[model samples]
Target chain A: AQSVTQLDSQVPVFEEAPVELRCNYSSSVSVYLFWYVQYPNQGLQLLLKYLSGSTLVESINGFEAEFNKSQTSFHLRKPSVHISDTAEYFCAVSERNFNKFYFGSGTKLNVKP
Target chain B: DAGITQSPRHKVTETGTPVTLRCHQTENHRYMYWYRQDPGHGLRLIHYSYGVKDTDKGEVSDGYSVSRSKTEDFLLTLESATSSQTSVYFCAIRVLAGGLNTGELFFGEGSRLTVL
Candidate 1:
């Protein structure tokens, strides 16, 4: 079974300040990592995913996550945050070829302007 | 929304009543999922369908049942409403043919149901 842990439950940051959201996973085999954003009352939208390759994955919205095998972590980072970035972020993990997903509790990113 | 919509965007129902939430998607994706969102738990899968009439239970499928009669529609039913069932529900879809290469999934806006 694979599981994910999002280190922080809530993170408050000022606009334009760099922010990082920590995520870690526990699995016996290969796994895929994903970050999703949920605005207020909306469903989750895919922010970014790390399948394989450079270890660092980026989203079109200036968010990035790095896959660290040694640390079993995939932390999300943004150089400059905006108030619009305020939302509930989730980290999820799925084993290779599996349909079931394991999710972290979630982190509420409160970007104050 | 990825051509996916959930009916009854917000609802407040009394306990012990029956409720059924609908999810419609025009994308024709082969995989459909039902998830619930709460304060700290994030999104938890309640049920999922791989194809019409092919359904599976998820982590929190205890009091929920799902059915899919067509390709575009998936329904979640609560046998008897309970206060614990009150939360925002979301429906998501993913293409099956793409295999694991499908990087992301399309999500519906969401349906907020409150059981009073």
Candidate 2:
């Protein structure tokens, strides 16, 4: 079984500041990684995914995550963040050709003005 | 949008009472899942279904049961609701493109259940 670990429980950052949310997963032979975000009272939304890619994947909203095979990490980062970026972020992993995903506890990103 | 909807968006039930939550999808996805969200425990899978009449337990399936009798509907039941079961429940459908599972999940708005 695949498992994900998000060491940080909460992250606070000032607006326009860079931020990074760390995530690491149990190494697997065929891993597919994903990042999902949930705003207050909203359902989870896909931020980005890494599936047999160039090791780096990006979201339209300027969030990016790099799949580090050796380190077993897929840390999410944004060069600069807005107050709207405050949300709960989840890191998930699943095996190729499988639909079951193992999600990390989650990291709450709190962006302040 | 995957056209997913969860019934009883908010409900208040008593302990030991039976509670059922329904998830319906118009996308005809082959996979559906039930998850519960708590303050520190992110989202934990309770149950999932791969096809009609097929279901499986998840990480937190101890007190939950699920059934998928049709392609578009998946039901999750708490045989005997407990205070510990008071949480936000989410239903998700898997999107498999070209027969490849990218692990993309689309979630419903969520059903909030409070047990006293």
Question: Which structure among the candidates has the greatest lDDT?
Answer: 2
Q: On residues B26-89, what C-alpha lDDT tens digit does candidate 1 reach at each position?
A: 9777789999988778788899898999999998999999999999999999999999999999
Measured against the true two-chain complex, the DockQ scores of the candidates, in the order shown, are 0.73, 0.81
**Cα deviation of B54 in candidate 2 (Å)?**
0.8
Q: What is residue B3's positional error in candidate 2, in angstroms?
A: 0.5
Fnat of each prediction, in sequence: 0.78, 0.75
Clashing pairs in 2: none
Per-residue alpha-carbon lDDT of model 2 for B8-96, expressed as tens digits? Answer: 99999999999999999998899999999998788889999999999988999998988898999999999999999999999999997
Model 1 in CAPRI terms: which quality?
medium
Q: Write the per-residue lDDT of candidate 1 for residues A1-113, one digit (tens) a residue.
A: 77788979999999999999999999999998999998886778889988888999999999999999999999999999999999999999987764777789999999997
Error of 1 at A47 (Å): 1.0
Q: lDDT per prediction?
A: 0.89, 0.92
Model 1 residue B84 lDDT score: 100
Residue A111 in candidate 2, Cα distance off native in Å? 1.1
Please identify model 1 stretches exceeding 4 Å from their true place: B96-100
Model 2 native-contact share: 0.75
**RMSD score of candidate 1 (Å):** 1.6
